[model samples]
Target: MPGTPGKGEEMASDLSQSLPKRTFKYQSSLPPLPVPSLENSLSKYLEAVRPFASEDEFKATVQIVRKFQDGVGKVLHYKLLQRAKTKKNWLEEWWFDTAYLEVRIPSQLNVNFGGPGPYLEHCWPPAEGTCLERASLLIWHTLQYWNLLLTERLAPQKAGKTPLDMDQFRMLFCTCKVPGVMKDTIHNYFKTEREGPCPSHLAVMCHGRIFTFDALCDGEILTPPELLRQLRFVKDRCEGEPEGDGVAALTSEERTRWAKAREHLINIDPHNKTILETIQSSLFIISLDETKPYSTPENYTNMTLEALTGNPTLRWGDKSYNLLVFSDGTFGSNCDHAPYDAMVLVSMCWYVDQQLRLTDGKWKSTLMQTVIDCGNVHFVR
Candidate 1:
């Protein structure tokens, strides 16, 4: 007879067997993201520019567009067609490179998405002195959601029963934009169910200091108690120590400026590049904010603005997600728009919000927990 299973073992077995194959099951059969025809694109472009262009400017633009459409555009279209023949999703790479990497603007206001926390509605009202506890629980739920994505257990996203494209969901974790002189590139360490070994480390930011530790220990995600211990250790050290230089600010600068600064930084010290690599390779950033509560309707608006742009000191604007934990136990997120759209983060946040609601934002751990020592990452500048 088989031995009786422990609670954890039984839970794991049930989860593995009960999860439906919904998330990426239909990805292969879904149509490729479409490319607009040159004529349609040019016509739409002209229409869009009409309000901004003078009559002479409009005429000149129209002539130029027509000439290009008849000349170089045909060749470009042919090339695109030829390329599409061999590629499963011909537009995906080009869209990513052009729409995100090549844009040389400040990404904080322009490319990052920020939103208010839903916990204010239920399961943990804005309460003082609960930030750390709430953050620990949020992080635990986040890791569980990440595991769902990794294991292909999350329900497939759809549009009225039709499966929508899920390619962007891959960038939700273990992704960051690497700065370049002319264009930045995304470094995505996330893998599909078939692909193996996504990065398991989580990066935490507090008091202008950044630290990273493995979220997984002994092949299981660290319990909320363990996460709380680690988070508290970082928070306590940050409180005691003077602030770090907040080198992450460079990421908020204009792309080219940041790229140049990054180059200089790397040249100044080889370790700088390694630190950048470490951050880029981590799953996501957890920002431990020390802001006081502003939970009123009017205050919520201010809080949203602050969350969107508040402290560059502790944020890595290029990372796909930055979960902000306020001192009042409220939360918010800033997400880079390059790798994925807002909906991917929205879905993840929604999942966590629902989970928190179900459990009253409390962890159900029984282990005897002690503070785990957290180490800070130092850059020689």
Candidate 2:
């Protein structure tokens, strides 16, 4: 019985045996997604002529030509005329005499200079700095350059010409206010004071009120009258310290004193007077259509002028726009062609910053977003 095992024991021993196991492997095969080309995304029409390096040269040549045409069209057609028509009230230290000349605003001003698209303009040199600041600087520089050309041509130095004084300068800005509008807070100040309100507004108005600085200048001498140079000189003297008869312009300190002595215009804020208002009023909106070639920037300038000074019937649609402004917070029969240039607008913005500093009695800061809403063209000094 010990030597012989039971049938159940035998079967149990056989069942305890191990069996072979089969294995299956997984093969990884798929690759990663490709990144899209940035150039291709930015310009859908940009074609790749070759995988070779020479392909770049051909593309550059074509683009440069296109850029040249765009720049020429913009500057000749719109930019130059806009510069001629849209004057800025220059600050005291920066003011230039334009009257000693005869500068004419041609019915149609044209130029052949070429470079780049308006948007790409600031990028050409790449030395102009970042996009935001460069954009502002570009606009500022372009206008300045054009103004200098016009001034040199129309108001050149002549023999036996007397420079202008303050009273004459201030008179240039006394254009009728736009009808039906409330009196500007700054204007109220000028009404009470003998000297005037703000220099910046006065400056801008002086610049835009005149017909043409170019019409008056020729070669080394200006036209016989010399009213143009005299007027602009008066503007500068008013902004700075003018020394002469009572005919001379008021200095910054003198103006400040007058502003302080004056009640209606003087406020807790120093920049709140007409001087600051002059700068604020010169902001303009220049319209541009990028659709057609040879459609010069001047075309747009003409369009803007028409909107401002042309017939009511013509002042409608896309053409009906405003490029020049001399807002005094008032509206009367004479609103359309009030004075004030773009530089004056820049000065006004700076003046606001100065006022905030003086009023708050601290380092003043501006919330440009707030400015966009509360202190744009409508926010008079």
Candidate 3:
């Protein structure tokens, strides 16, 4: 398969489009997480294990815990204190590695978190014949949110007067994880206006195929009409060709296996390496799903399940976020667990949902509050 596009090839490429790269960034403020005292931790552990322990087991555990608390635990606790003195957040790195990057399992089934957009069904229900239109609209709104952060126009989130950490927001876009044999590493391409350029491109997948274009043109975000044209081009291209090689499925493989496969793929063709980097550095993905996952205002299980477990070929499991746009006019997201805080994703979803509610679920022009009516549906160009 060297120098030839055939079996085991990286199917994500071949449209052969290119664009100028752009940059992005954000701000954050949060205190270090407090470490619990050893006595408090030990008592909680004992409480949790009581159900599994009989009277004798419980008594023996108490004796062992008392001895360890005075002996090994004291020394370990001192080490933890030393670690805390050296690191602002002693547990952060350990949690990241143990909970996600170091796990060798398939990320799709184990690490990624997928769910329906917050209250999305209310504004954009599962209506037929509205996939592409609504998708373009949604993408435009998402870019607007990204723009807020990029321009530093959005205020730092706060709880009362204290600023909550907004670090995860920056990682929500233009971020990805590269697989390693023992540990995966996050490649965040976002940079502050002062830090210089970050990627402004967007990658979209249709029928297991990927096509990318810069989300911004001439230092400005693309309008919804422009995005629709680009999406339509990808869809049309897919219709004319056979099913793609579905190489993205490899991302769902065991981390070590995926790392090895990726290495072989790159060695087979240098272009394969470029395509992989393009995907990793681009803004999060948009998956154009053909399946109609029925969902409504109250329940999003169908949509959520499909987003989490649908076509592995359509999802780049290591990306920080993969927006799933179903043919039934529903939307959900599959996000990596690295910058895996829920509130970061939730705040953006919540913002877009509110925007939709304000406009009564109609697509509106960026310059005005109203939309141009066309064929019983409102549109913005």
RMSD of each: 4.6, 33.7, 10.4
Candidate 2 TM-score, C-alpha based: 0.20
Worst 10 residues of 2 by lDDT: 106-115
Superpose all Cα atoms of candidate 1 onto the true structure and report the RMSD in Å to 1 decimal.
4.6
lDDT of 3 by residue, 1-381 (tens): 011222112211211113122221213234566778999999998998899999999999999999999999999999998898878789989998998889999988887898887545566767888878888777877877676556444566667866666677789889999999899998999765555787888888877778888776555566567677777778788899888877888989999999999999989988888889889998889898888888876777888889889998889999998998888888889988887587788878877776667666665554532222221211110
Residue 227 miss distance in model 1 (angstroms) = 0.9
Report the CA-based lDDT of candidate 3 relative to the real structure: 0.75
Stretches of candidate 3 exceeding 4 Å from the true structure: 1-30, 118-120, 366-381
What is the per-residue lDDT of model 2 for residues 1-381, given as tens digits with 9 covering 90 to 100? 111222112111111223121000011221222333333432433343334437677677558645754676444545534543444321221221121011112101110011222222112222211322322222232222222222221122123542222111121222222111111111211111222322112121221121112211222112112322333343453346432221101111122232333333436556645533333233221211111122133343432333234322111111101222111110101121123333333332333233223323121123121211111112122
Q: How well is each residue in 112-214 modelled by candidate 1, as lDDT tens digits? A: 8887787877777778988898888888778777777787777777789888887788889999988888999888999855677788888888877888888
- CA-lDDT, candidates in order: 0.79, 0.24, 0.75
Best by TM-score: 3
lDDT-best of 1 and 3: 1
What's the C-alpha lDDT at position 106 in model 1?
A: 90
Can you tell me which runs of candidate 2 are displaced by over 4 Å? Answer: 1-135, 138-160, 164-176, 180-294, 297-381
lDDT, model 3, position 377? 15
Using Cα atoms with residue i matched to residue i, what is each candidate's TM-score against the true structure? 0.83, 0.20, 0.86
